[model samples]
Target: MEQHVQKQPDSPVPFFLWRHLNTVRRLVLLLVFCLLILLPYISLYQNFVAGHAYDLLTPHERRIYDVMEWLTAPIARSDPANNLNMIKGNTWSGTLFGLKLSDPLAVVGQVAAQFKLYWPFLLTALLPVGLTLLLGRFYCGWICPATLLYEINDAVRHRLVRLGILAQGRRMDLRLKYGVLAVGVGLSTALGTVVFSAIYPPLIVGREIQYWVTANGVGAGTTFFLLTLLFDLLVARRGFCRYLCPGGALYALLGRYRLVRIQRLVNRCNDCTLCDKVCPFALRPMRDAFGQECNNCTACMAVCPPRALTFRLRIQDQPDQGPGHQGPAHRRAAVRVTAKGEVA
Candidate 1:
């Protein structure tokens, strides 16, 4: 006799939206990376034309250059001195909707340089830090160009693992990144410069890409960025981001009181461990719901077969319901889980 099987219901709209959002998020990151590479070349070409290279340009090239310059004008700085040295006409800093987008670490270094805190630097730092308070390390997961490279390396590693050519790498202590941050801050304070920028992967990659695009050669930081890629590929998956990224450590600290978090339905979880396996940061969403280490990537939510996970906004003092409850009834669950995976 033939047996009949029951099919499970489809996931809720939020889950479906989350799956598509992940794809959109990746596309956005790729677009940002491409823009970073292209902006420098555009600036270089415009500068060359302004310096009499215009006579050598084809009509079509001239039109393209004019259009690009106009398009990038709002975000691009006009003063050469204000731009990044490598990308002379391309600005490293800009305002987005009147909000400053400068690096907080750079701001800290500036304050250390003067041996006094400046209100302007503090105000500039607040823009990114305030966003982090709402989004929770979203920059690491959604925008950082180095994260794009890390994700590529991670994908390659996963393929190798499936083909029996690589092993599942061990997860390092999350505190290592904090320790690295402390050391970097100490060095920057002592040296009175942005010491972290010299080796920071994102900044290195940006400078290198700008150099390559404009000068047709790699920059001083290229070697450091490439070494970071190698470390991610062979030494440990996401080694730089997880344990050595001072910038990430700063974000984690800034995002400590993030309003949004990943919520888990304990009753739905069957302990399949798929969510844990898919997390690039090695976050165990099933066992440690809403952990601060979570970058809010939602990869776990997308991979969860039972639709047990979803992003939610909750107060810091909310109770943690161990694994089974769902919704408003579970609002007062036990204490929330800390970054160390301990019940707080």
Candidate 2:
């Protein structure tokens, strides 16, 4: 029996969508960031002015509140304060979504406070940890507010470079982040406090946003957060996220063997090296198929002229056999090139 193979359409719509998917996802995350910043104010308004929760709002505010409530319904807990602070303790926390978000370093600190005291608390961190194990530091690419700032910083730097005003800074050793992570874990264990979160840019920025939106003022974390921005803006390109962030370090280590990764199609590639230049993390998607440092940010793929790069699931032990050698060793394929040269 003969099987009919469907050919890809020559329309530019699919290509357009694939190229802009990352931008769309980034905008969605930015929207989430805005909502998170506004949530506290919404809660305060509901409690103080409205004098009730969710029921006594103007139609507009009511709609926004309903959306937030629905989004956070899974991890939402009954707090006496009736505030939207999702953190329950040093162990379990919540993000904009209902999923429980936990910093592994913070959990370790709680564990060190007294193993028996925080042993049960460790369970709360499993969700994020499991996600990292499966997805490879997706939080850095998809959710972290720092990535947004880094992208802005990178764009400005690119413009400056085009004008010959800025020189690309030297690349630092990636191991520095891991070293910082080790130091943070050591200090947390020794001091009996979650030291990493206090200085972590993502957490600090989130807290500062909450404070600004709710109280119309900056919080204590603002200074440190600004320093991180300065470090990215003037000192080096993506220096904080790439070299010093202990949280990123934890994610990178936890996600070393993650199944999802960017793969290169050698036949389609023209060796323009644009992907390498566009990557904020300095990943060479053209050369490395399964770079552990890659966060799946899709920046490289966005700039690829031939669309040679794509996300795929491959076995950890699979050999780096370059491209055009798609063997049975690879399990799942997430993208395919059709006869008409369109990616699907």
Candidate 3:
């Protein structure tokens, strides 16, 4: 007779979408972000009109909209009634610049004069505030290209760690991001302008691509694009996210106060240890589900056969008794019995 041994279930799609360090998924998102830069490269017409299609007035929304507009460019089309190469106003260039400065390195490009007018600033602030009130950082998880880049990096780095090439995971290095935030804000204040947005990733990729097209032509842009792609693919995960991105760092700080949380059950846990194995962020959910590192991906909950974990609005709401919270010694004993039963 064959004995049955249970294994952990795969992580959920959302977790896989952004948090899973799986190479295939990371490749898909990376391609998507690259395609975003390729939008204006293809057509001056689509670049002019649809270029700002997603560029809402809010800082975060404009950033996300620009990224989406760029990524979806291959399929974007204009009506034949609108000529492909008609003269467009300077407004288009302005929109392009507004989009580029959002990058951290400003490697892509910069354009501040076009969209930084007072009206646009009002619009930028409203969007993030409104969304934060309604959704609680969905922008960080679902939209922001910077976050997407980091996720891709996270996936790659995790693989490197698994292979023992990297000794430990990348941390935001707490002080580093804070220092960046301080300097960026301080400079913006001293300069009497919102200059920090210039280095943000969305703007960075946008500007770099645009500059490459104008100065060195497509070859330069293509070269850097390929280089970044290679780094993302072969390197440790999220080379950019862990070490470089300030916008993502801002979101992580805001995310620390997020009301929605993934929680663990202590008593009912069989100590099968599936959650720890499945977590891609190198977090020990067994020790603390609310660890600051958790991005709320829910991989642990998905794999728990006993349904030991969940996303709860409040940690206090948890039933006060669940399988995930048991002490380590208790868990070890439980697993030993499970092993013995299987052996017998």
Best by TM-score: 1
Query: lDDT by residue for model 2 over 216-273, one digit each (tens)?
Result: 6886688887788778767678889989988888888999999877777654555677
Query: In terms of TM-score, which candidate is stronger, 2 or 3?
Result: 2
Off by over 4 Å in 3: 1-35, 41-119, 133-137, 147-152, 169-175, 191-198, 210-244, 266-284, 289-294, 299-307, 315-344
Q: Give candidate 1's whole-model lDDT.
A: 0.70
- Could you say which candidate leads in lDDT? 1
Assess each prediction's global lDDT (C-alpha) against the native. Answer: 0.70, 0.67, 0.47
Instruction: List all candidate RMSDs to the true structure.
Output: 8.6, 9.3, 10.5
Count of backbone collisions in candidate 1: 7
- Over the stretch 1-344, how does candidate 1's per-residue lDDT look in tens digits? 22222223244535567756667778877977886777676666557545766667779667766776666666556743234233332122445445556677667656665578777667866777778888888888887878888899889988998898987677678899898888877888888787877877777777778777666578668878878888887777888898888888888887888888887666555556788788888876756554566788777877877677777787352355454343222323322333335543
Q: What would the TM-scores of all predictions be?
A: 0.77, 0.74, 0.54
lDDT of 3 by residue, 208-232 (tens): 6656543455434344544544554
TM accuracy, model 1: 0.77
Clashing pairs in 2: none
| Comparison by lDDT, 2 against 3, better one | 2
